[model samples]
Target: MVSLTERTRQGWLPLFVLAVGMSMIIIDATIVNVAVPAILADLRLSATDVEWINSIYSLMFAALLIPLGRTGDVRGRRRMFVLGLVVFLAASALAAASVSGPMLIGARVIQGVGAAMVVPMTLATINAVYTGSRRVIAFAVWGSVIGGMAAVGPLLGGWLVTDHGWRWAFWVNLPIGLLVLAGATRVPETRDPSAGGHDVPGVLLSTVGTSSLVFSLIESQRYGWGGSSPVPYAFALAVLALTGLVLVERSRARRGRPVMLDLSLFSISSFRYGGAAATVVALGEFGMILVLPLFLQTAIGFTAFQTGLIIASLAAGAFLSGGIVPRLAKLMPARRIVQLGLLCEAAGAAAIGLVVSPGLGPWTFVPWLALYGLGVGFASAQLTSVMLAQVPSRQSGQASGLQSTMRQVGAAIGVAALGGVLVTGLGGAMERHLPDRPDLARAVRDSAGAAIAGIREPATRAAAVEASAEATRRVSLVTGAVLLAGVGAALLLPDTGGRRREEE
Candidate 1:
């Protein structure tokens, strides 16, 4: 038998490679927000086009996850992971070279397809290969990469946007993707020989369902519900598609045939409850991510680079928390730890909400942001462990893909719902402050909170800034409330003891 010492040496290199591969996809999701203004100007994008750029990546990513994960299971995971990197790198080049909004948005959609292929393979590799305390550590690192890199993207995006221009933001992926390609050799290949044939119907139904749902949520910000837009119809189609998907999968499973997602997984209490918590947590966390930088740049008038620096506190806190959480894992169940982490997030965000003002120092947000980061670190890291604890290694890809889909769907909804809240609140506050100028109010809302600083008159700018602060305050409070809901979901989880099945 291989000794523990030998296993450690063999695992660490591939683990490093996989984590970085995973990081690229997660960071891409939020990195563009800080660069959106530059993109809008460079491409002369319409408002609808801007929403497509921001939302299409997530929509495609969420839609294809289950099918791709199942494909990886049937074919070979490491092969798919490598192929995905190639696709993503090529798309990055296309994105960087784009001269128009539609071209760039099309590149993002392709990037999402590649991302969906890579993400599940990374997590499934870890779940299959690692065991004992090493698995715990591997999960902590995986989770930390996810939680930390998301916040880190804005900082990197801010710097890149401020200096090299927005295209460089996509251009920057070239070297990193190449490095990951080189390191791909170290990652072990895994697949389920017994996973059986593909369920073609399940694939189509799930893809259409997830795509429609996410698309509708995305459109909610621009068109609102129940009006002349496609939002209502898209949402209805999503429901019908998803329901058909469930029926088809259950029927196939009952006959001992192939299925994309095994409905039986939900029978595992940890998977069900833990997944619920993850969804809610992502809903809150990503909204905060999308809004905070806008508030910093527009109301406080900080440069994107400066805004990124201030926001880095969240990343710092998350990384710092990663350092301690493995030890904490030894002492408590993963569920309890997740609950505590969400509580911390709720507290920190609510506190930040109370303190928004034009004159508020950038550094003032640091402590609260740090606390929120710590919360993200703990919750994100442990939730992976908790959710996958009872899952068979053969199905790890499916579980990982499903959980990741929930988080993406939650993120899409969060961006839509919270974005809508910001617009509505900003419009009302603007109306109260400048009732005679609806056009100015429309401009501020349309910019995604970017236009407030551009107001020329001192008094008009002051009113605009205050309106932004109030709207930001509302977003923060809503974020806190959503995290608190996650805490409730986490509380329902069955505790899988830390270091479960560990050696040493």
Candidate 2:
């Protein structure tokens, strides 16, 4: 067995390029979140429309990731990677230039398509390119970059939105994209010699099924829950599609044809457990990304930039942990390390619940958030390394795709479920306290979400809005508690910690 060491000068550059492109994608994911209000104001969009703008990108990306990952394995990881970057760059430009809400959203869907292509292939490429200690380092660095950018995206967006306007935030990607494109051209191609061509039916089933499931979850918040028409019907269709997808994959596996996601991949205990852990971890992390900034800006009355600064603590913690986890992977058993990571996350969340108060300054969020990030960093790096480590080299793409899909699915569901909790909790709290006053109640109900931005009654709006803010703060604290519980679940993951095997 040959080792895929990262000693070559040429190899490092492309990996760095891969990191940059990934940063662009992750940054864009959260960057638009903080500036959503600015987008809503500029485009005169509705809440549903805004949700689509966000959901479309994730839906398409998550839906297509598996198929694209398989395509990268069969065709060429490098080819798919560059192609994805091109599409993403083009879509970013289109998104930036949009004249209307729908146009921008259409562009975002395309951006999601492109992101779907890029993100999975990047991981496949890394798996192909590095081995041994170097492979561990590469994943650690990649994890840090991802965590760092996610943490900083809001601050970056806030500054860009506040200083140069929101368009500049998307525009910022253009130059970076072009540079990565150029750099990517110089990298060595990673091709799996035994990999087969694209699995068309598998692609259709997986993409359709994933999109349906995501759409159903996103719509659940809007519809009043009783009807079998939209929500129930959509969910039913999603289940059927996913069931059919499983059948299709099984058929392919039986016939000896490669499928987009190989069910056999999950037979590896380490891979299965690690992948599941990764999915849950993503749910907690990405969901927090959606909620935390809103908490800071809406509840604590922090400016976007100030909120960004506080969120930066998350990245700092991740950065600090990213560097430390790989060495820890070398030190402790994998299960113990994962357990420790989970404990750290729980502690961090509990700290946030205890310390995060409306009257507390932005600086107060820093330590708790950093602690959370540290746990996130440890789990993230080890999780990816462990999951991919168990996969056969030929099927690495499938493993990467499956893990990425799970992560994104977790993210989508997390935002929908947890965001729902925050919104509904706040609304219920407001209704309970202020429902007797019709005008004030109407104003509270009209606020659209946990944010009181749309409320109109000036005389009573202030007090009512304050109540809403407090409610949202309480909800956030609850969310933190729930997330901590999730961290506790990480204790059951398999012990796979050690030096990377020379054969892997």
Candidate 3:
């Protein structure tokens, strides 16, 4: 077998393999957004089911990361990473074949499982395989992937769905996954010799707690936040279960047992504050990503392909910033760069909110989204540096795992929160504008604002379009506010100057 030294010294091949794998996983998370209208045309999915299809993948992925990441540390990161690829590929095939809403949702759940297994291991594997400048560059590439690929998905999914069909989006993952697997041999295997004794209870509690919370938020849009729905019940379970998880993990840590997450890491101000900002920023960005495509196509009358091309502006700006950040690092602190980027995002989102109208062409969104993308680029990469800067080398894996989990949690909740706003906001518009057409309003709301594009009745379609525009404005403004909150959190960080100072 090739040694870690031998394999990694082969230059950047291992990092390339890992980055491809990571990119495929990240792309899948947002790819569905640009395809939601097409999927609705085929599956006849309800608004609730649409939210499920959009969010369950993330919810499960977020809930499982910490536990699976620790498992990777003990059981061989390479083994887990390989398994994740196979599982994700299989799940993609199943998703393409899904015949019903439940079928697609199930496939998404499996995809999330596969994603959870792959994501942490990729970071851990890179940590295990690289050192010094190589490690820094590798992690920088990883950060850029997270920030850029997310925005790029709409374009790819858009083209695939517009031309071949939405199913082709899933089909496209097969070749990428296979390519990664072929290169897997060059990636060095690693395991922690002292990693032992899994925290089974903590795992169970964390999963249950986080999943319940996400479920409530997503379902709350459909079931109503307060009424006879299970939203309240799920919220209660989440509160109780998450509290139990904290208590259980703390006890395990105190008694010198293996734990899923180290609570003590929060003692580091950078990790705590940086983490808080990362979560909100992800929520703001992803929530907007989900809603923007729906609005662009449904109200502005853009083709799926056109919508994708426009949204690609965000990724374009992000990649452009990726190049700029290295140069900017010499003149300013990383934290300052992060906060600056977030301010860009907030401004971009606010600008988007102000411009949304049924009469407006989708192209009006390009500059703002690109500005937002630039912020994502600067903020995400440097924010990561700030968060992990103070972490001890020995605890790097654990720290990375926790930060990843928090970001996933934010992404999952963002999907639900902003989505909930759109659905409920549209419903309110229906009540006010089309009071006699309750059934029509319900239909439009259940389609996740997709029906507005196809409603042939001129008056009704106009109403639906108006409603959709209002809902989108709400989503965009709320996204901007959340991003501003992230900016605030970034403001709170103690100078995270040391982490990236070496690069200067």
Candidate 4:
């Protein structure tokens, strides 16, 4: 058998290929945000409809992560990665050609399924191919790509939407996906040698549970929690599904069968707390990202290209921090570093919230955005390493899947929760400003972009823009509060000196 030592000498090419593949999915997660307004306008979608378009991707991705991760471990990581790319490529093309809102969202759901398969294989393959200090470096590069690609997605999407059309945002994935597929040929096949049969029950439970939870949250704002609304019913169903999932997994464990997720992993404090911190970070980061573009385009009158450039400042900070994190880890405890990062994120969010105004230009946001990105870089660069440190190499696939699941769950819920805040705030603001015009207020509440388009009076348009800005500001403050909670979660992580420790 070829040792991992010989494999590390294969150099960084494999990691690069994996990063490219990883970036395609991560970028897709947020790339649609920059194009959301355009899609809504083109397809005549309501705000709730647009939210589903952005959210179903994350929802589907989160639901299938564990099952697919288990599949890779039972089958072959390389095989699954290649297969995922093909599905992703097909879905991207379908999404690009979509002429209606439902068609585009259905394509996104398929894309998310492919993403679930691709994401875990990258980290699991990296774990299989590298060891010791080399593994640490590999993870840093992996983390950097995750942070950088997510930050840059909006920028790339903005340019595509500005220069071409919203459809190009999906079409541009074709060449990149093909290139990644070609590069994947070099990656060695890997899997858990002792892996057993699939856990069909666990898969079904997790998928239904998570999807139901996300759907309930996303639709709650549209359909009131009371009266004839289905929100409470959906919430009850989610609770039942998730509770049943826990019972089924516990039963499977007693029988010594393969489990979709090794629930025992949560017993380790680093894994448990690290997953929590990562989830909170993702929630705030993705939620704010979803809202900022709408505020920029609808409230501040920036073009898509201009909005992308402004958002790029966040990526710039993340890239610089990601590059330096490895060196920083050599000097300080990873836990303290993560704490500092969360503090920075919280501070930046607060600053942006306080300074936000309808009259302010994009340039006013650059510094705060960069600060937030720098914090994200520092936190993301180390959290995965921290979480996976206690797991043995054989279980990397499961651990990676769990981490990705948490992040996606956070993202799905963030879009729903923070988006609800934005929508509710807009409604309240409009009502206070225009109490006599209930019909007009309801229209504005449905879609800010559409409302701005319909209002012919300059004074009314200006007031609507102001309301949107205030709503954005309120959401920013909420995001800052969420980051502060993440700081608390980071505090629970053990102060390991950036080194992996064996499970006791």
Q: Kindly list the per-residue Cα lDDT of model 1 for residues 296-339, writing each as its tens digit.
A: 87678777788777777887788788888877867877888899
lDDT (10s digit) by residue, model 3, range 227-253: 589999999999999999999989988
What's the residue-level lDDT of 135 in candidate 3? 68
Give the runs in model 2 whose Cα sits over 4 Å from its true position.
1-11, 354-357, 437-451, 454-459, 474-478, 481-489, 499-504
- Where's the lowest-lDDT run of ten residues in candidate 2? 1-10
Q: Write the per-residue lDDT of candidate 2 for residues 184-254, one digit (tens) a residue.
A: 87666787777776678877877777777777776776774575548777777779888988898899889
Q: Which candidate do you rate higher for lDDT, 1 or 3?
A: 3
Best candidate, TM-score: 4
Clashes of 2: 1
Where is model 1 more than 4 Å wrong at Cα?
1-9, 44-49, 145-152, 499-504
Please identify which of the two predictions, 1 or 4, would achieve the higher TM-score against the true structure. Answer: 4
Instruction: lDDT winner between 2 and 3, please give it.
Output: 3
Supply the TM-score for candidate 4: 0.97
Q: How far is candidate 2 from the true structure (C-alpha RMSD, Å)?
A: 2.9
TM-scores of the candidates in the order shown: 0.94, 0.91, 0.95, 0.97
TM-score of 3: 0.95
**Pairwise TM-score winner, candidates 1 and 3:** 3
lDDT ranking of the models: 4, 3, 1, 2
Q: What TM-score does candidate 2 reach? A: 0.91
Clashes per model (N, Cα, C within 3 A)? 0, 1, 0, 0
**What lDDT is obtained when candidate 3 is compared to the true structure?**
0.85
